[model samples]
Target: MKTAVLITIGDEILSGNTVDTNSNFIATQLKEIGIKVLSIFTIPDEESAIIATLKKAFGMADVVFTTGGLGPTKDDITKKAYADFFEDEMVFSDEVYEHLRTYLEKRNRLWILDHNRDQAMVLSKAKIFLNFYGTAPCMILEKNGVYCFSLPGVPYEVKPLVKDQIIPFLKEKLALDSIVTRIVSVVDIPESILSETIEEWELALPKHISLSYLPIGSRVKLRLTGTGKSRTILEKELDSEIQKLIPLIGENIIATHEDKIEKILGELLIGKKLTISVAESCTGGELAHLITSVAGSSAYFLGGIVTYATQKKIDILNVNPRTVEDFTVVSEQVATEMATGCQSLFKTDIAVSTTGVAGPGRGEDGKDVGTVFYTVRIEGGEVTSKLFLPHLERLDFMNFVSQKILQDIVSLLIKKNKSPQLY
Candidate 1:
């Protein structure tokens, strides 16, 4: 199959003021549809450069994608570039102008002028794509079996337009085969160990199934993509292979999709109409903040505590100072107590807590940095302390600990869901 070329138009990109994220993003999306991105080019908002690149891209690739220069700003020059290439007059469309007017009117700044009018111009024969997020209408020009697409440069605008509209159209037009993808999330485990253990299984994968690892924050995601005529056969092979490789580190699997642990917890709590609370130490209020970041959180989140200082842990969460002294600050006992205390304080069905060393340096007890501990307490589920990394700087440790805690909470929720009440 022929490949697609992604062209990013911007003076800012050449100057390095803004990264060319659209190219990478488009490449990923294209790959999902079994389309290959042959080359990516970024140029200043100059007409000659853009025209030259477009001509080359149209010849070299099956389709050409241009983003970033279709905005209302003066720096955006894609409008004239499209007008010049199509050999057509540029006229403002009432439909696009209404959209642009509404865009500025919502923000209360609708002023009809050349700049705004220019942003609304489209080729008479071009396919118009509405922008759900921005005013720059995407134009698709087709000629002699070549496709050229232009979109707003901004990530927020370009991403949705391309994802929701452009990709689907391309898929249908190309008669591309359906893509089957399998994803798995693993937490409380490093990518290195998982990779090392899964080496053999990975090698056994068929040529159609390609594996890629995307490690974001503290979690590692394994995504397997397979392109073929038989999706069922591929999915079975993928699921069986995933299961076979999983037993080596089954305890660390978070969920199959890209959802974070906190997100998984939110879904569980909301589905069951359960509520949760958190207590924190070295991880800060990040655990609570993570839970609240989701929509409809007020329905499931009772509350939480920061308790950065030991006194607050003792006074607010009722953490026994003796336990803190006996096991030191970053101990399993303290983590358990914190979880239980928050569960009681919030009076919710579930609660999670963290007490650990997130450190740029060693702790007061000379313990190595990143000595983190997590505890999860559900009404009848386990109250267990799981230790993760033992050495990382403060920021890394905080991020790692929060991820571990979230994973623990999710595991407990899953376990609780499986087991019926003994009462």
Candidate 2:
């Protein structure tokens, strides 16, 4: 496989002022076209630092891709650094000047300063790719049979250049093949236990296929990637491996496709033609937000109630006052009542509730922080409640509980036909 290195230049990234997303975007694109990214470097915009990083990166791989510091500002010296590193000087390009002039004129940016026009300066002996999206042009330099591409750091500029220009150039230059990837998401199973259970099946996989586990919230994503001369063969091999894995871990797998928990849950509800509602306390409307985030969610998601106050839960959802007085707002009994109340309020087929104390400190009834009780109720059937104590931060705790609630809902739906109590 062809190999490449990515370098992102910005002091903001190091100081945490800005997150470096350019490297990830470039790396993923490279991988899809059969270029393996060896390493990624993040550095300041200092010319000497950029030169040093570029030299080291070019030494390690066939291609070096750098983003950032290609603007008109004083801090943008990536172009100068490239000139110095290549033992060349900057040369003004009339073609680039006209391109910049037309770009600025069309945008009604008539108050163009000299610095803005300086974007036409080019590195001598380098190939230039015009940036359709921004002022800074993409640059390509070749030395000792290695190629280095310098792209604008702005994500919008980088995306079009990579997709329209860089990808095509690299494809013809490297003669790359497509890389196919498939995802199978499993939930309610710890990674360690899942690995142990599927060790034998995993070991029997073909050499070209690789499996990676990525954990999100309470779910584990099994990413299967296969690269070969033909995309058809790679997909077939990946699908065959997935089928083999099904018998081993299919029961634990909530989604066989690459989608978030909410989308997967939404699909399940839509497939079964079931309508749902939610009653939330500590998680607020987070559960509702997740459900409604999916497109066409109105088809299955009826509505939700954020009964943050215990009195609201009692008065609005008609939870028995005695129940909260005896079991507390964060108790399983309260969660169950909330779910049942939601079913009645929305008149839906299914309902879920989240009652928790997602806090930096303890909540009422002596419940510790991150203490959450979840309930999923089938309108005419049984209710399942689970207590999850993840001890996460306030927002994280809310997000995790929302995901867990959806997970529990999917699990119950999967077993509703098998279990007499669930039906």
Candidate 3:
């Protein structure tokens, strides 16, 4: 496989003001054509930093990709840095200047700043790839069989250049193969124990196949990647290897693709022709947000209620006042009541609830910061409740709790579908 290195340049990215999503996007697209990204470097817009990183990237991989610092600003020094590093001079390109002029004219802009005009500067020895999406042109420089591509930092511009130009150019220039990947999502098992249980199966994988473990919250995704001359053969092998995991792990496996818990839950609901609703407290309707994020969720997701205050839980979800008085707000009794109330309110086939103390501080009941309780209720059937201590910050805590609620509901549905007894 051809290897590539990505360099993302910007002070904002280093200072946490901006995210470097370009590298991930580029790497995914390149992987489809059999190129693998070896490393990624994020640095400030200083010329020296850019030069040093470029030198290192060229030395490490056969191809280098850079995004950022291409705009017409004082801090945009990537062009000069590349020229200086290559011991070449910046030459004006009439073709690029005329393209810029036409671009500005179509937008009816009469005034052209010198900085904007200066975007036509090109390294004399580099091959230019004209950017129709932006003023700054994309350029490729080759040294000792290593190719370095410089592209605009703006996401919109980077997207067009990579999809329309960079990828095609590289595919034609190099003999590349097809790379295929499959994801097997597992839950109900801790990552360490899951690894140990599957250690033998993992060791038996084919020579061309590699496995990576990506853990998120209570779930771990086993990603199997394979490279070969034919995508069909690669996919078949990956699928066959994934099938071996089913008998080994059984229902601990949630999906054969990388899907969000809410999405998987939505599919299950749709498949079973069931409708659902939610009642939330500390999670604050985040469960609703996740459910509705799926494209066709409205068919199964009836609605949600956020009852942060105890009185609202009583007045809206009709949780018994005595239940909260006896077991407190973040208790299993209240969670069960909330789920029951949501089922009655939405008249849905299933309902779920979240009552938690997700915080930097304890709740009114003096429960720990990470204390959480959840309940899933099937209409006219069973009600299940559980407790989880995620111990995460506010946002992460909310996200994890929402996923847990969906996962619980899915597990309930799976059990109900497989059991001899309806209840």
Candidate 4:
């Protein structure tokens, strides 16, 4: 088993201007290659500071990953620090200089095109990673039988290089097996109930496996991880564990594979040739956004209505004004009416609606914050509405309400066999 350490090099992270997401990204990729992360450090991108941290990191782990400070900025100092720490000579390389020249010419930053080439040369004898994104390239240097890689700070560049390049390289060189993590997402149940319900299964989990509870808003995901094995073996064990747990949790499972509910809905609607629409209020346009996020959604998503205000709910979605004044917009009567109204208006096969008091504030009848209503009307087939109470702040209340509507649509599709529904 190899131990890994991540060093995030930036002053901005230390100053709290930017979060240090690079280290976690690196660690996650490393874990997939069976490299256990032993420690993580966020340090100033100063020559001495980085060198000292690298020394400590090398002592604790087999592979060290350092990100940030690898751009063509004066404050970016990773390249200098690594060269000094390794006692490696800094020499101009024709290959790196040429790369910088062409890249700058293409981007048309002619002001310092030649100077930028000079800035990009890696430490003499160090293997260079031609960063496809920025001027300061990632570099790798080996010393005393340990491995170190310096990577770019930009997320788009670092993510692919680390996940696709760095981890695969290490796996091959070190003869490491892939580590895999699987997620089972569930909804409509609070975390406390979920914890108590699965306490025994959790305690009985194997030493080779770890079950982590990730509760985000109204949903709870069970993440199962198995490290230090081939991907097939890890997946087999994970599947077995999830199968055993599923029967126990029964109807609580919403979906497998950790994907969002909207994604699940999109697939189902597209596959079944089922068109859909949305009538929304408290959740604003959240349901529509979730559906559209999946490409090819245009096939099934005809259009929808946004009835946030009382007049729009009445005139647009045809929710009767009396319904809002009587049972209120957040009530089940209004929810059902909104779904039916939108389904008819859009002429789609289904309509999902949301109306509620997403409040740290008050509603028509002083409905509490987090009071949400979700409805799914499957085009002249059936209408289902449920009162949803998601844990959320009033200002961000629409987020949870929006998410709940998406979730319900997926749930209906699965039940109808357009998609496979979980418990």
Question: Who wins the TM-score comparison?
Answer: 3
Q: How many backbone clashes does every candidate have?
A: 2, 0, 0, 4
Off by over 4 Å in 3: 93-115, 125-135, 382-384, 388-390, 419-423
Q: TM-score, each model? A: 0.74, 0.87, 0.89, 0.84
Q: Which residue ranges in model 2 land beyond 4 Å of their true spot?
A: 93-109, 112-115, 292-298, 309-322, 345-347, 364-366, 382-384, 388-390, 417-423
Ranking by TM-score: 3, 2, 4, 1
List the global CA lDDT of all models.
Answer: 0.79, 0.86, 0.86, 0.78
Tally clashing residue pairs in candidate 2: 0
1-423 in candidate 3: lDDT tens per residue? Answer: 899999999999999988888998999999989999999999999999999999899889988999999888888999999988988999999988888888887887737735498888899998988888778889999988988999999888899899999999999898887899877777799999999999999999989999999987778878899998999999888878877888888678777764677878888888889999989888888999999999999999999999999899999999999998888888988988888999999999988888888888889888788788888888787565555565588888998878877877777777777631111
Clashing pairs in 2: none
Question: What C-alpha RMSD separates each model from the true structure?
Answer: 5.1, 3.6, 3.3, 3.5
Tens-place lDDT per residue, model 2, 129-218, is: 998788989989998878899999999899989999999999988867678888888877899999999999899988888889999887
Worst 10 residues of 1 by lDDT: 414-423
